[model samples]
Target: MTKPIRKAVFPVAGLGTRFLPATKAMPKEMLTVVDRPVIQHVVDEAKAAGIEHFIFVTGRNKGVIEDHFDNQYELEHTLADRGKTKELEALLRDLPGAGQTSFTRQQAPLGLGHAVWCAREIVGDEPFALLLPDMLHLGARPCLADMRAAYDRHGGNLVAVYEVPQDQTHQYGIVGIEPERDGAYPITAMIEKPKAGTAPSNLAISGRYILQPRIFDLLAQQERGTGGEIQLTDAMIQLSREQAFFATRFDGQIHDCGSKIGFLMANVAYALAREELAGPFRAELEAMLAKG
Candidate 1:
């Protein structure tokens, strides 16, 4: 039987240096696009994919993320007494259902692998999703939701893949693949940020992943790999050799909100997607572009 993905690990421990000054005081995951913080979008996606438990791997200054999901009884009561049910309901969506959310500290700036390893105990022995909050995926169906569907059918580890320029593949975890018809492929290998022109394929693994719990064991034995950090790709490469590893090219716009320019672009893209802000936002952006 295919194990259901009931838990999701969100690695939000990194000090987002790209948005610094602003990010200096606040956790990067708490920064908002439109009205939702980067982490909130990821949580919403996991929730939509039937994730019953939310595990946030956090660090210092990430209290706001926890606070964002906790109850504000006084505020709720005030909104209720004023007949602001719509606003109250909207606010409630951010609050994790009781017993559904948990947080743990990474306590170090290791890397993605170590960050994910921090949540191993909570994840136990079930399949789980890993979301990189810095990567925002916009779609009618959230990226995690799409991966969940793929997991339901394929029943092994799955990662979201998107085609990028060969030169740009060096910036991401490039996957070596064996075709499985249409756009799906069995990931033969995964390399972290290979030099340009040396990538096995143009397909790069984005930050979204549906992983099996056994991966924790692999991660535990993994040494400092690429980039002098415990790279998740190393553990995943080992995990792939023992079981299935697949990638699906999702139909969505993936934004690298980790970079300054990309973060600004995300704000503009999201602002343009909002009905109330679209016209004015587009006009201002167009005028700004025209001036440039």
Candidate 2:
């Protein structure tokens, strides 16, 4: 039987150098896409996927993130005094139940692998989900929820993949897969940022993952690869040698919010996804394009 994925590790320690001035004083994960913070969206996805524990690997200036998940007593009191039941309810709705969230400091700006490794004590000896807050998935169903379903069937390490343009494969961790079987592809190779034309397949690894606990051991021993910082893909590649790795091509539009263009696109995409906002937002967008 497959061990249920009860905990999720979120690596939010990145210094969002891409966003510059805005991120200078704020963690990029706290940036808003529509009204919700990017980290909140990722947490909601994990919550929807039946994940009971949220482990955030954080950095020095990420205190705001911890506060965001906690109750604001003054704010809640003001809302109550103002008779703003709806507003109060909205805030309460998003709050995680007591003791459901945990935070650990990464301490250094190492890399994705190091951030995830920091959460090892929290995750214990179980398979867990990993979601990159920057990669926002817009779909009928949450991306990680889909991955959890796939994990139930395959019972091994699974990474969410989506097809990218062949020439653009070098920008992502590309995966080579056997033919699709029951919506899961057996991943034969995972190369982090292969050369433009040397990629084995067009399927790029999206930022969602369902990984076994053994990956922590591999990441602990992992040496720096690609960049001077340790790369999670390097450790994953090593883990694949002994365990079965599969890829699930999720159904969604992924907006890479880590980049400026991707961030702007996510705001627009998420705004258009809301029923109350979509019609007016589309009309405004059309009008702006016409003026241009």
Candidate 3:
């Protein structure tokens, strides 16, 4: 019998060089979209998909991420004293319960595969979901939840993928497919950042993944691919040869918040999606655009 995927691994060890000075003192995962921090959005997505254990692969100076999930006793007490029940409730609504979250350190700037491997002890031998906080997806259903449904049906490795332009395939991990069934298809091959015009297909991997435990074994032996970093894609491709690898084309707009433009766009997109901010935010954005 296939074990249910109850745990999730979040590789958050990277230094956010792209964001520069802001990230110099703060973890990139702490950056906000709309109102909540980026990591909070990711945790909310995992929680919505019924993930029981949250394993965060952290690094030096990432203590804030840990504190974010912990109870803020002083802040909560102050809110209670001030009779700010609603604010306090909102703050506590999404924080993970004690013992539900586990933090492990990734001592070096190895790569995605290495970061994932760092959480092996916490993840144990169960299939787990992996979420990259930088890639924020906005849709009716959470991206991980959509992938979870696909995992339930297929019971193998699953990755959330979407169609990109043929020319843009080089920018992402591209997957070759067999055919489609229920918005998912059998992934024949995965090519990370394939050279221009050499890609098998334009379907690119988004940041969500539900992987089998055997992947940890493959990642253990993974070599550096593409850039000098040990890519998770390289390990996944090897796992695909021995297991059923599938990709689900999720319904959502993906915001690549790892880049400056993408981060700004995500903030705008999320703000415009909010009920309280949409009206005024849209008007101001239009006004700014009109002047530009």
TM-score of 3: 0.97
Task: For residues 81-157, write the lDDT of model 3, one tens digit per residue.
Answer: 99999999999998888799999999988889989988888888889999998999988899888888878888889
List lDDT for all candidates, in order.
Answer: 0.88, 0.93, 0.90
Name the lDDT value of residue 226 in candidate 2.
59
Model 1 spans with C-alpha error above 4 angstroms: 181-183
Candidate 1 residue-wise lDDT, 189-232, digit = tens: 89888887889998888889999988999989999975688989
Residue 275 CA error for candidate 3 (Å)? 1.0
Q: Give stretches of model 2 more than 4 Å off.
A: none
C-alpha RMSD of each candidate structure in angstroms: 1.6, 0.9, 1.1
Give lDDT tens digits, candidate 2, residues 138-249: 8999989888888898899999999898889989899999998787899989999998789999998889999999999999998887568889999999999989999988
Better of 1 and 2 by TM-score: 2
Between candidates 1 and 3, the TM-score winner: 3
